[model samples]
Target: MGVFTFTDEHTSSVPPVRLFKALIVDSHKLIPKLWPQAIKNIDILQGNGGPGTIKQINFVEGSQLGKMKNCVDELNEETFVYKHTMIDLKEKFEFIAYEVKFEPTPDEGSKNKMTSMYYTKGNVELKEEDIEAGKERALGMYKVAEAYLLQNPDAYA
Candidate 1:
C-alpha cells in the first residue's frame, strides 16, 4: 500500500462557530437537503456526534459513485479540529485518514484547511489528477453549503 496526502484551504464569510455548527455538526442533515445531487445521505453507524462516531456517506446518482465509512478519531470543539479514519471504501482509490481544521481568523471569519491522506492498493495507485479532482469536489461541496447557509441561515438552528 502506498500512502499519499493532499491539503487544501478555503475561506468562509461566516464565523467559525457558525460554520462549524452548520457544516461539521449538522452536516449529516444539512448536506442532503442542500446538495442532494452530490450527497444522498449520511448514516450514523455508531456513537452520536462526538469522537468514535462512525458515519457512512452515500453518493448521489450517476457515474461510479460509492459509499465511504469513516470513524471520527478526534474532535476538539475548542480548537475546531476534527480527524476521521476511512475504514472502508467501495473501491481501490479511497481516502484513509482525513483531518480537517477550522481556524478562526482575527478578521471575524474563518479558514478551513482539509488534509486527506490515503493509501492506494490492489491494482490502484494514487495520482495527482485524482487528488486534484477530489479537492475540487470537496471545495464545490463547501461552496454549495456556504451558499445554502447564506440563504437559509436558520436551517441548522
Candidate 2:
C-alpha cells in the first residue's frame, strides 16, 4: 500500500465559527439544499455525528459517482477541526482520509486548511490532476457554504 498526501488552503470572508457550523456541523442538512443537482442528501448511518460516526453521502442521479460512505475520525468544535476517512473505496484506492481546520484571521474572516491522504492498493500511484480535481471540488463546496453564510448573515450565527 502507498500513501500520497496533499494539502490546500482557502480564505473566506465568513467567520470561522459560522463557516465551521455550516460546513462541518450542519453539512448533512446544508449540502443537499445548496447543491441538489449534485448531492441528494447526507445520512447518518451510525453514532451521533461525532467521532466514530458513520455517514453516507448519496449523490444525485446522473452524477458520475453514485454514493460514498465515510467515518468520522475526529471532530472538535472548539478547535474547528474535523477528520474523516472514506470507508468505501474505488477499485484503485484503499482509502481516502481528509482533515479540515478552520482558523480565525485578523480581518475577522477565516482561513480554512484541508489535507487529503490517498491510500492506494499495492504500488498504484494516483495522478496529480485527479487529486487536484478533488481539491477543486472540495474548495467549491467550501465556497458555496461561504457564499450562503455571506448572503444570509443570520443563518449559521
Candidate 3:
C-alpha cells in the first residue's frame, strides 16, 4: 500500500465559536438546504453526534465522492475545534483514510481555520483533480455557512 497526505487550509473572519457551532455542530442540517446541488443529505448513522459517533454525508447524484461515512474523533466546544475521520470510504475516496480538523485560529474568535488531511491507501496515486474537487466542496460548505450566519447575525448564538 502506498501512503500519501494532502492538506487544505482556509481562514474565515467569522469567529471561531460561531463558526464551530454552525460548521461542526449544525452542518448536517444546513448543508443540504444551502447547496442541494452539492449535497443531498447528512445522516447520523450511530451514536449521538459526539466523539465516536458515526455519520454519513450523501452527496448529490453527480458528485464523485458519492457518499461518505465518518467517525467523529473529537468535538471540543471549549477549544472551538472539531475533528472527524473517514473510517469507511465505501469507494468515495482514492485514499484509505481521510481526516478533517476545524480549529480556532490564533486562539481568538476573530478568525477560524479549517484543515483537511487525506491519507492515501495502497499504491494508488490520488489525482489532483479529484482531491481538489473534494477540497472545493469543503470550502464551499464553509462559505455557505459563513454567509448564512452573516445574514442571520443572531443564529448559532
Runs in model 3 with CA error above 4 Å?
90-109
Q: Model 3, 1-157: lDDT tens per residue?
A: 4455666666665677788788888888888898898889999999888898888999889886789888888888787667778766544344334444455556453444455566655555668786777678778888899899889879887
After best superposition, candidate 3 residue 106: deviation in angstroms? Answer: 8.2
Between candidates 2 and 3, the one scoring higher on TM-score is 2
| Best candidate, TM-score | 2
The Cα local distance difference test for each model comes to 0.79, 0.90, 0.73
Q: Considering only N, C-alpha and C atoms within 3 Å, which residue pairs clash in candidate 2? A: none
Q: Pick the candidate with the highest lDDT.
A: 2
Runs in model 1 lying further than 4 Å from the true structure: 90-95, 122-124, 153-157
**Tens-digit lDDT string for candidate 2 (45-123):** 9999899999999989987778888899999999999999987788879889999999999999999999999999998
lDDT of 1 by residue, 15-68 (tens): 677677777888788878877877889999999989999998888877355677
Model 2 segments more than 4 A misplaced: none
- Native-to-model Cα distance after best TM-score fit, residue 80 in candidate 1, in Å: 0.7
